[model samples]
Structure formats: structure tokens, C-alpha cells
Target: MKQLQKLKILDLQDNRIQGLIPNDLCHLQNLGSLALSENELFGQILTCLRNFTFLREIFLDSNKLTSIIPTNLFNLEDILYLNLSSNYLSDYLPPHIGRLKAVIQIDLSVNNFSSNIPSEVGGLQTLADLSLAHNRLQGPVPESFGNLISLQSLDLSYNNLSGVIPKCQKRERTPPQTELLPTLAHGRIAYQELLRATDGFSDSNLLGTRSFGSVYRGTFTDGTILAIKRLDIMTDLACALDYLHHGYSTPLVHCDLKPSNVLLDEDMVAHLCDFGIAKFLGEGESIAHPNTLATLGYIAPESPQERINMREALAALKKIRHQFTQAVKGEKHEDCIALRGESVGSSSEP
Candidate 1:
């Protein structure tokens, strides 16, 4: 095995291959994709992979691995996907992870990583999806996350993260930090017309439900289809009110945007409705407390602002639609019309 070189792919995933990854495995300079997930593997992984300069995708999740992620691991500029979730990893994540400029998706959920996520993580330009959920991470999320312009989806649930979410546009600040975090753009419900087409969110129009609300299928007068969200006004009023008031020029936060808050019209357009907690933004207005906003779920994890009105909502919706577009192989919005509306999954919001 000493002379074998130039190997590009080695996949030993879902196997009983125990013991430390052969230290000699790094001899292959051409190695790109390595899958070692779902095993009893232990010890630090980055050094084991240090020699594979060309590595792109690495899967080391679901193992017995421990210790902090090595800083040297981020030296791989070409890595696009990395998974280290579901393990016994502890300590704070490497601070300069943004160095891996090409990484697009990363999952570090279900681990023992503690303290605040580094502010530098917002520097990862190409990152689209990131998850750090189900961990012991604490402290306030960094306001610098507004720098992640390419970021589409983020999950920081089941953690000790605190503080208001960041906004897209900056409002005037009073003290402490004179700089106001970016304001979140409002979300656009393009499928509002579709809701009309579906007969105003009827029982026949039901699509799905979650802990916060229920979504329905609808169609516009112009024959456009959309998804209509009917939120559970009884439960999430505090969040709904906070968002509408603090997060907008006029304050229009949804307070509870979940699967149920989304709906589809006859034309297959998606709409977010149910302004039960929708608030009008103004100075000194209190949805609940001046320190925090809305429920825990549905609200973006990094946002420190109070508003998530039309523009921000639209941005999130576009991202979701983009994900759906890729999942159904270009369904053109109408191809995957299933009759079954799934039950609403529970949300993390209070």
C-alpha cells in the first residue's frame, strides 16, 4: 500500500471499519471525496486528512469522534460540502472557517460545540446552507452575519443562542453600539392571487400544518395557484406582534412563519399570510420586551432586528422555491401537485 498513489475517491461509509483512519491514507494527493460516516471512528479527523490537498467533499458524521475541529482543515479551498454532525465533538469551532471560501453546505448539528459561533463564519461567501442546531452553543449571535450575502438557509435551533436577529437595513441606534444591524428585507407572497383562485383558503385547499399554523392551497381570480398560510393566532401572538412592529419601516413581521404559514394556490404560487402578530414598526413600541422579539422558530437565527416583513419574507421564500426547484427537477411550479397535505411539523418558537 506504500506505493499506491493518485487515488481520487475512497468511500468506506456505513461500514464496520474501526480504528483510526489509516494515517497513510493521506498519501493520495488526488483524494477528493471521502465518506466515513456512520462508523465507530474516533479521534481528530482533520490531521488524518491533512495531506489530501484536493479534498472537496468529506463526510465524517455519525461517528465517535471527539475534540475540536482542526484549524488546518479549512485550508482546503475547494471543499464544497462537509458534515461533522451527530458526534461527541466539543469545544468552540475553528474561528477562521471562512478560509474555506468554496464550502457551500456544512452541518455541525447535534454536537457538544459550545459558546458563540465565530463572527468570521459570516465571511464564508459561497455558503448557502448552514446548520449548527441541537448543540450547547450559547451567547448572542454575531451581528456580522449580515455579511453572508449568499447564505440562503440557516438553522441554529435547540441551542442557547440569544439576542435579536440582525436586520438588512440599519435603523438609527441609541447607545452602546451606535451601529444598527442590517434590516431584514420583507418576504413577498407572490401567490396571494393564487389564494384567491383557491377560494380563499378553504378546507379543500389545505396543504400542510406545523406547530404554528396551517397552510392551504388556493388560486387567484386570474387562475394563478398559491399557498395560503393560516397561522395559529391563539398561540403565537407575542411573536407575530413583535415582528410586525419592530422589523419594518411600518413593522410587518409574520411572528410565525412555518410550514403551515405557507400555502399553494391553483397556479402553484407560494404565499405567506396570517398577520395575527403583524405589527407596525415605530420607536419605543413594545411587542413584549425591548430586548427580544417573536417566537423561537420560523425567525431566522442570525437576525438581530425585530422586523421580518415583506422584503425579507420574499427573500426567504425565493430561497425555499429555489430549493424546491432543484428537488423536483424543474417542475415549473405545477408538476408536483400531490393531493395529500402533510401535517404541520412542530416549531422551535415559544
Candidate 2:
């Protein structure tokens, strides 16, 4: 390894290298990149990384390395990327992990690290992508995280995090380039106006209920209409809502879509009102065959060999609804359920 001192790039990934990463590998002082991921390496990471002063990127994921991250690892001020995901690394990340000022991407996901993300992580003003998914981490995300103005992708999913999500804060900005028309009063409104408009979410404003919580509609003092769905904490509704808004790489599956669980805006535009049973697609996550449909009135008389997509089911139901001369609202409306339970009704929730 001493003969490779002049090498700037090393690709040892997927090599099934066994035992500890040799300390002498750090002798390559000119090395700017290293890839040792997807190997069976075990034992403590060598403490000699501080000598690789020019190293800008490192990939050590998918290894069996143990022990806390060494304090000297962050001495690489020129480092711009780090991937330590999918390892047996344990213990809380040092608060100084954020001291790697040049790191623009970090993947600490799929590890045993527990505890809250340190607030100092917010000081990484250049961070664009940060993934802490699939860990034992608990506690609310640090409020300082919102200070990452350059952040475009953030993943704290599959953790034990709790508490309401922090709302975006106000910052100084120039006046809008375009003037507001008489019809357009203001550019934006505050959430407090929404809470007050719902009369503190009195039941009279309630529009629907789901496994998570209830949905309400309210008109602000400014005549701004909004729908607020207050979900229960124990139901993990906050994470579910966040996933629906930002985590999915594809359109999500809301298998239990129903009128009572959906809220309509003033223009009749609909936003998903309940996330109690939401599932992200394109990630190998599947819809619960019976539980999902049962809540939406698709309880099958027999086990299905293949799952039916919601679009196909809705199309078939529309045909049935069009054929009904009496115009049954749906198979699960109180009156319709009574009739169906008596074996005299047809069609299900659309």
C-alpha cells in the first residue's frame, strides 16, 4: 500500500475484504477518494484517518465496523461526501459531526445510532441531502434544521421521532414583482388565522373522521378557506403526513380513500385528509389487502388471488352507481348500510 502513495482514487468496493481496514492504507496522503463499502471488514476503524488531509470523499457503508466514530475523522476539512450507512456502528454521533464544514452529503442511515440529531447539524449551511432513515433515533427533529436554507431533500423516516413538525419560519424578502389585483388580497396568511377561523376546531366545523383523527373546514376572518385535519399523536400521524408530503419517490397509495376521509377546498380541489393507512409506492411497500379495502367498503366475499387497483374498482363502482335507478349514495352511508345489512342495497364507497 505504501507504493500507492501517489494514487488519488482507490476503488476497493464490493471486494469482500475481510478483517480490519489496514492502517497503512492511510499512507496515501494524496488520496482524495476511497471506496471500501460492501465488504466484510470488521473491528475498529483505524485512527489514522486524520493523516489523509486531502481526502474529499469516503464510502465505508455496508461493513461490520464497530465502535464510536473517532473524533479525528472530522479533521478532513476538505471532505465533501461521507457514506457510513448499513454498518454495525453504535452510539450517538458526536456533536462535532457537524464540524465537517465542507460535507454537502451524509448518509448515516441504517445504523444503530440512537438519540436526537444534534442541533449543530443545522449549522451545515451547505447540506443538500441528509438521510437518517431506518435508525433507532428518538425525539423531535431539532428546530435548527429549518435553518438549512440549501436543503432540498431530507429524510428522517423510519425513526422513533415524535412531536408536531416545526412550521417554516418567516424571513425578510423583497416585495413581490407583480402587484396584487383587487381579487388577490395578500400573498400568504398565517397558521394562527387558520386555527382561530375553525372556532378552535369545534365539532360543527368537522368534516370527517378516520383511524387517525378528524378533519375540519374553516373560513378565516379574511375569507380564506382552509381544511385542517388534526391527527392523533399515537397514530404516528406526523411522520405519515411528512412522508406523504416529501418522502415518496412516486405517487403514494391511499387505499382507503373515502368521502368522510377527504377534504375539499373552496374550489373543490381535494387533498388527502387522512394518513392513518397511507403507503409509499415504488419502494416495495404493499397495501394491506383486506384492512385497507374494508375501511373503504371493499370487503371481498372471498380471498382475492390478485389485488385490485383503486382506479379499476372505482370505475366498476361508477358503472353500478349509474345503473341504480334510486340513486344509492354509496354502500356504506348510514341508510345504505342499513339496507345492505338487510340484503337490499348495492354498490360501495366510490
Candidate 3:
């Protein structure tokens, strides 16, 4: 591989390749692109990869690669795309990540990364897509993230992050006309237009219904079909619970948090309707049992015996959401339920 100094691109993606990336391949200092994704490759990314100054893209996702990211890899200022997701990489993201000034997309999710996300990531002015989900990251999200002016998509879910997410300012610059999709040419539609599109939201157009709201299949005169969801209830419910549990001076717990207590306004924003059984906990207090119990099958299994705090309830809700998401993706999530059952059973012991 060292003899191939003129090799500009090395793409072996989706192959049956196994074993460590050859150190000899790093000798291709003039390489412009490297793609080895969806393979069985294991071992840390080659540190010498930093020497490929001319490289513009790197795709090493869906592999078994482990170890902390090489700090020098961030020095590739001209690299446009970088994907290291679905690996076993562990350790704090280096602050030098901001050095990728020209990077457009970055994916570092599904790893063992811990600690606060580097605030320097906000410096990637040209970044459009970023994902750090399904990791072990902790601490509040960086406020500097609001500075990502060109960001179009971001995912930071399924982590241990807390605190309010900073709102990102809208981008001032319009994308080039060449980049606009044909569907976007119609611009925004009005409520009456939506009603017409979904044929008055007839039962024939109904796609599905969940704890939140229903989804309908809408069709335009031009035959463009789209799925429209009515309300953003789940997010609103989560925010309400978070405020009650953490934002207030005296932590409040909605003892009965069933779907019936969730109401939606004309704007489709959910509001917690009934607080008849709410409980306020004093400082240093964690659990509180109200005189009235929540609806059966709605609260946790141990709720009846040992009352749980709002934080625990929120955690349980998130776990259920995660399990449901996994199941929808055709993944096995019985282990999560089994583990929860084991913990509940052990805690009930005398």
C-alpha cells in the first residue's frame, strides 16, 4: 500500500473485510477520500490518518473500531464529511473538533463517548448535519450550539443530558436556488389547504393513532402524498413534567399522569389538564405518596407499595419510549423489560 502514494480514493465500504486497518494504507498521504464503512473492521482509527491532509471524506461507520478518537484527525480542516457512528469509540470528544472548519456533516452517535459535548463544536459554521445520540454523554448541552448558523439537522437524544436546550437562531442566508427541492417550491400552506388536502381529515385518510395524536395521509392536487401528524403531545408532556420536577422551588409531582389528563389546544400543543392528585415535595424529599392513586396499569409496578418520585417516573417513561422506538425499528427490546422487572422485584424484598 505504501507504493500507492498516488492513490487518491480508497473505498471498500460494505465489503466483508475484517481485521485492523493496515498501517501501510496510511502511507497514502495524498488520498482524497477513504470509505471503509459497514465492515467487520476492529481496532482504533489510525493516528497517521491525520497525515492525509488532502482527504475530503472519511466513512468508517458500522464497524467494531474502539478507542478514543485521534486528536489529530480533527485537524483536517478541509474534510467535508466525517462519519464514525456505530463504533465502540470511547472517551471525551477532543476540544479540537472545532478545527474542522469546512466540514459539512458529522456523525459520532452510537458510541461510548462521555462527559460534556465540546462547546467548540459550535464553531463549525458550515456544518449542516450533526448527530450525537445514543451515547453516554452527560452534562448540560452547550449554549454555544446556538451559534451553528448553517445547521439544518441535529440529533442529541438518548443521552444523559439535562437543562434547557438553547434555541438556535434562524439562518439569515438563503440557500442557492440549485439546492432547493421541487416540493419546497410551493412554500407553506394554510390550515384550510391542509383540510382540503386531507379531505376534511376523513376516516379514510387516517393513518394511525397513538397516546399523543392521530396521523393522516394527505394528498395534493398534484398527487404528492404526505403524512401529517396532528399534535406534538409527547414533547409537551415531557417539558411539563420536567418543569414540575426541576424548575419549581418546591418540586411538584403529578401523581396521576395518564393520557386522559393530557389535553391539546387549537394550536395542537399539549397541556396537563388535571392536577387534582398533585403532590409538592419539600427540600431533600424525593418520594411522596398521595391519598389518591393513579390509574391502574398507568403507574409503575412498585408505585403502590413504594411511591416513586417524579424523576423516577420520568425515567420510566423515557425507558418505555426507548423500548418502543427500538421495537419499531425491528430490534429486540425484551431485555429492557426483563431488567426492569428484576430491579423492581429486588427492591421489594424485605
Candidate 4:
């Protein structure tokens, strides 16, 4: 590793590399990225990571790393993307988590992190995607998180977090240069392919219609099924309103959320599919019809009167899920009782 001093990008993903991450690799003073994901690497994250002063990215996900995070590792000043997901890493994050000044993406999901999220995490002013899902974290979403004005996609689901969400502090509003679809770098189908799958946008393939346009069920040559919502806003222009509204660097207002605007994938995962009237939270006023608003049924009523944070959203969804489960159970019980009654009557028939 020492001989590779000029190596800036080291990718060992999907390899069988086991054992501790090489401490000597830090000798590469100019190293900018390191990806050791999907490996069997184990042991503690060492303090030596701080020595890599110019390191900007690291992918240590899907490993067997354990123990509390070393606070010294957070001292890496130039690190940007840090993915420690799908590991057995335990303990609470240190307060310096907020000090990741240049870091943008932090994924600590599927770990055993316990205790409150440090309020200073709001200090990650440059953070875009912050995921702490499936941890053992408890307590409220930090009020300081409102200071993460540039935050976009956040995943704190499956934790024990409570309390009302702190209204995020508004920061400079910079629209993403790239739209949302481009963010799905994987499994992307071209416009021509979409057309071919939907038989030139024929009505036969139309699954539904929405405020923006129609949705067609498309099946590619690989037999992958996808629901495509044709929107009026961008066969020409483009944006990532679905990603933008849900977790774009800031909370965005999806002004036209409705049944028609929602697409269900083969997995039945509901995706926000329309963005003709979306607004970034920090963005002031409407440029279009001032009163143009969200669909009456689906749109969350104006804030204050009706507002919810991420935690609240999770709770609400859980409640709905519980209700559905209960209803299904009730139906199954009735069916069982009815079948038993029929069986007894037939047995007793003369």
C-alpha cells in the first residue's frame, strides 16, 4: 500500500478482502476515495483513519465491523461520503458528528447505534443524504437539525426516535443541477425503451391517469415491470420532485400529491410521481397561480393547522399498517368460522 502513494481511488468492493482495514493504506497522503464494501472486513475502525487528511470518500458498508465508533475517525476533515451501513457497529455517535464539515452523505443504517443523535449533527451543513435507519437510537429528532438547511434525503426510520420534528432551518436554495431520475443511476431505461415497452404510449397499457398525465404499465425486454407516469411538465424540461419533496437538501412541498400522482411499483412501493407544482420549503411564494395548491385529498393541509415531521410520518404510516393488519385478521377469522360451520352442517346431513 505504501508503494501506491499516488493512488487516489482504491476500490475493493465485492471482493473477499477480510480482516481489519489496512492501517498502512493511510500512507497514501493523496488518497481521495476508498471503497471496501461487500467484504468480510472486521474489527474496530481505527484512529489511524484521521491521518488520511485528504481522504474525501469511504465505503465500509456490509462488513462485520463492531464496537463504538472511534471519535478520532470523525476528525477526518476532508471526508465527504461515509457509508458504514449493514455492519454490526455499536455505540452512540460522538458529538463531533456535526463536525463533518465537508461530508455530504452519511449512512449508519442497520447498525446497533443506541442513544440520542447528537444535536451537533446539524452542523453537517454540507450533508445531503443522512441515513440512520434500523438503529437502536431513541429520543427526539434534534431541534438543531433545523440548521441542516442543505439536507435532502433523510432516513431515520425503524428507530425509537420520538417528539415533533424541528422545522428545518432554511438555507440558501440551490436547485439540484441534476433531476431526480438521474439520481437512479442504476436500472435506468431510456425514453425509447419506455416507448417500446408501453407500445407507443397506447391506452391499453394505461394503468391510470393523474393531474399531470397518464401512467402506463411498462415491461422491458428483461421482463422487469415498471409503472411510468407521463407528466406534462417534462418530456422537455426535467426535475426530481419526488426526491426533492421527500428529502431534497431541504423539505419540499409537493403541491399536487394525489392518488393519480402516486405510482406503485411491482413491489407495491408507492413513489411520488408528479411534480408539476412542487416547492422547496425555503423557497418563498408561488411563481405560478398563487393559490395553486395540492390535491384536496392527498395534499397535507397548510402547515400549523396540519404538520408532521419524519417521526410523525413514520408513526402515521405504522398506524395505518396496523389497521390494515387488523382488518385482514378479522376477515380471516370470519372465513375460518364460516368454513367450520359448513363442515359441521355437511357432517350432520341425513
Backbone collision count in every prediction?
63, 0, 0, 8
Measured with C-alpha atoms, the lDDT of residue 249 in candidate 1 is 44
Tens digits of lDDT, candidate 3, 257-305:
6778776655465656555566666677666645443342233323244
User: In angstroms, how far off is 297's CA in candidate 4?
Assistant: 49
lDDT of 3: 0.74
RMSD of each: 21.0, 20.5, 18.8, 22.6
Q: Which residue window of length 10 is worst by lDDT in model 1?
A: 335-344
Model 1 alpha-carbon miss at residue 191, Å: 40
Candidate rank order under TM-score: 3, 4, 2, 1
lDDT of 2: 0.62
Q: Per-residue lDDT of 168-248 in model 4, one digit per residue for the tens?
A: 776755544433233234546678888888999885565444334456767677655566887544211112232233222
- State each model's CA lDDT, in order: 0.62, 0.62, 0.74, 0.66
User: What are the per-residue Cα lDDT tens digits for candidate 1 across 1-350?
Assistant: 44767565667889886777677776766666778999989877757566666677789999989888887888776677899999888988777687877688999999999988898887776788899999999998888777776777889999999996564332335753333222212434444444555566664454434333455555444443345665444323323332233323443444565668655444344454554453333445445333334443244322345345656664544444443334345644431121112332222232
Off by over 4 Å in 3: 174-350
- Name the best candidate (by lDDT): 3
Which has the better TM-score: candidate 1, or candidate 3? 3
Which 10-residue span in candidate 4 carries the lowest summed lDDT? 341-350
